[model samples]
Target: MEKYHIKLTEEEAGLLSKIDLRSYHQNHEEGRAAYLNNQEPILALLKSLSGRRAVPEVRLSYWNDPNYRSGRIKGSRKGLFERNGCTGSDIYTHPHFLEQLRYFLFGTELPDAVIEAFEAKVGNPEWVSSSDIVPIGKAARDLTRRYRLDIAAAPEEFFKLCLDMGLGLSAAESVMRSVKQVR
Candidate 1:
């Protein structure tokens, strides 16, 4: 896998934590209200620093379905006790908002090295299981720990590296920001 070094300062880490706190609030009714109330100032700060929008609505209904694995939403077996009625629409219900949010938060462009690393990790059986289909989440976490200590690259660079190593984009971004302060 392609390797890049990255580091984060204390202030940057704090800012990323605040962003995560807001995101957590966005999931529930009360949290959503708090998130909405604080949206402008957070957006202003994120915009000034990264020139991108940070408040993106994310629906996690698919995550609630027990039968759902990886990105696939499988129909429950007839005899199964836990029947999941989740459909494809439930998984991809809000594509437009997701796309827009991703673009706004993380730029449209991914670095070439990052893409190469992703291709390498994703195609390997060691990284992706055939029966389960869930990519090895632990491996991705380990890679983040391995790379975050290097002082050569910026937090965003480390974030991209985490994504390339099989971490979800939002998760990787969160981790990247968590390690450093962003103001």
Candidate 2:
């Protein structure tokens, strides 16, 4: 495998730079909303390149549903819905997406054994544990950092990484292209 030094295009760098760690705890609602809205331009750019790839479907049945948010923080609930809905993070990070991305980028899909190895390397006890991969807290920060670096390094590699990470390929490609064009 070729080791490509991924550099973020100016737009990607700008986007990554906008992410503030404080938003994770202080103004989660605002942060989520902002992230959700930002997806629009990125998605548009991806569509231009990949021509309408399948958009990840996010289940929003719990957003306004009182039954779901009863115990959850009131302000955070809606924000969660918007962010998950817009970015399709709920779906993108699923194993299926990871497999698709791996296939697209490396021309080799991750087998079950490989996945097990990866989980071991990451030291995640519950590989698919919802609690372990809480999107509201640490996951968000980690994603922000990872994405920023990926976009900054190699747009193509970052696109491939997104796919491998279960984010839709077209969407990733589009965002990368936008970053490239801006730079």
Candidate 3:
């Protein structure tokens, strides 16, 4: 496993500071892509800040219908997943995850156990599509609180930045696991 050091410039920091929350969410898809691509710099930022880890619960499409706002946050997996709507690839343990990990993290393929983790989550019924393994909003909030920065306030670029840096975290974790295996 190889380690890459990443940093962000003052200008880029300033650029992020000026972006508003509405605009960030409005461009969520593009923002998500950019967040995925330039992950290392954001990871660098997070490490310097030393943010907290928080698990967030997101509202899944089937779980939280607007008409049924009373039952928005569901605790059970029953009736949450639409059997008809689900495809083989849409499940969590699909091969696409390993392929993405290979492309982003290393020249070599991921270990079988890593792949198994994904497979373990597949069709579990409890698995929700709305939230990520890394809770972006809460992580951003943690960074802001610890660093005394206004990350969660507006233009919430901090949150988006956290989301963007998911790939970097994944790579770092993957490398660490691989190194442990070698030892």
Candidate 4:
């Protein structure tokens, strides 16, 4: 895969900083609200992109309705999504949007595996045992230092950057996989 050396402008960085990455990844509604609420920068950034053609309206839709089970809340959001015209292409994953988002957030186009690792490990306590916390954290710190990234101030970003930059699969695997006792 070709590597993109992405750098974020001060304004873009500030805009991304306002978003809570953890909530954006872990909780759908809260994250969507944050993005929707702080969409000026996002729209401006996309507009500035030379390769971008269509600028999507930043709004909420229910493509992945966590409340779609047989209950009162079921299809509640679906109707809203239909009314909002959010049923088309997922704007969040659109190439242009992702390109800008990745640049602002990770400073590079991280692989899908790395992104998955982040969603799996960070803020999910069951993935890593208490004993493994220190080691995993230390590993993340060391990896970030090696990459010369200044995101260590934020541990969440630090870990994601490190894992993507070449922290080896061990850190993610160690945290994500449970040890199976040999019979």
Candidate 5:
């Protein structure tokens, strides 16, 4: 229910775009590690979350998407389908990463295998077969209705909200300021 606006030039926005996002998500760990590594600002903010609980929920919005209301999730090769609460885009959270949050923030560490075990139990929801994510048009509408989102966010502001979670004043102002410079 919390919202932040992040702005990016066409270039940084490229980093935030579905293209690089797909690239970052393709291999999951290594891909994101590589992606964030290249993106120094995002990496710094990610590290800043050490020992913190209740990190912000990362939900992306396709502001320019118009086909948001059909409620039909499309598979890359196939037309539309629904599995569980998920529609498409195999966005599985890295349990090890989340476990770190629990460990740092709550002082409890879950076994590395827990995430996989949970996935195995719940069944993984694979996205449309192709790596190309055809813009999350279907779910965007639902997301819009459910969450109060800003028109858009400045990349730095988005990262701050990502780190601070709108809980209070973010402590990462310097980091955010540096990010603006990079952009």
Candidate 6:
């Protein structure tokens, strides 16, 4: 796999945390156009990478999520559940937001209908039904692990990887310099 060093000032890193792509995802509920409009920054950033190499494989994990392993996905009043693959908190904030960001940036092989179902809060009575919803945990895990994710080539990708690596929003606290990818 190929990789590139990412250089970002503190300002850029903070932007990652500020980006709110998950709020409209079945949270408050917004039309597709409105949802995309609210998240223009994320879309613009992704568009900027149009000709660049696709995002490198990411090492997102589900820990030892027995539920994820057992293929038991749940949809409750709180939100969907699949072991550590996701939580109500994650869906509302942080790492899950990060994951959502990854989803938009990298795109998915999942059918457009599946993506639309996830993006919209209405329709799809299946949205509230666990049995009908595609198991996102397994799909996300499998998509993320397709390649040995050894490096990141973009600042956005790097920031996300930092959080995925458990550096959290304060990844700057530990590595104040830019990300460097090795050949």
Task: Quote each prediction's TM-score.
Answer: 0.24, 0.21, 0.18, 0.28, 0.17, 0.23
Per-residue lDDT value at 14 in model 1: 53
The model with the greater TM-score, 4 or 5, is 4
For TM-score, candidate 4 versus 6, the one ahead is 4
Best lDDT goes to which candidate? 4
lDDT of 3 by residue, 103-139 (tens): 2222223233423333243223234234433333333
Return whichever of 2 and 4 wins on TM-score. 4
Best-matching candidate per TM-score: 4
TM-score ranking from best to worst? 4, 1, 6, 2, 3, 5
| lDDT of all predictions | 0.38, 0.36, 0.31, 0.41, 0.29, 0.35
Candidate 3: worst 10 consecutive residues by lDDT?
A: 53-62
> How well is each residue in 44-79 modelled by candidate 2, as lDDT tens digits?
332332343322221122223333222345533445
Candidate 4 error regions (>4 Å)? 1-5, 23-29, 51-100, 103-183
Ranking by lDDT: 4, 1, 2, 6, 3, 5
Model 3: how far residue 134 lies from native, Å:
8.3
Clashes of 2: 13
Off by over 4 Å in 5: 1-3, 18-183
Cα lDDT tens digits, model 4, 55-167, are 21111111233332123445633444544555543454332244335433344343445444444445454454456655555544444444544452234343334344444
Q: List the residue pairs that clash in candidate 1.
A: 11-181, 12-180, 12-181, 12-182, 13-180, 13-181
In candidate 6, what are the lDDT values of residues 38-105, reduced to their tens digit? 35444444444333433333322222222211125643312343434655333434333445444434
lDDT of 1 by residue, 1-183 (tens): 213222224554454445433224335677656544444434434444443322222212112322322224354222122244434323222222233223334432345544455456556423443332223333333444554434333454445444444545555545444444422
Name the lDDT value of residue 54 in candidate 2.
29
Deviation in Å, model 2, residue 8 alpha carbon: 8.7
- lDDT-wise, the better of 3 and 6 is 6
Q: Name model 3 segments beyond 4 Å from true.
A: 1-129, 151-155, 159-163, 166-183
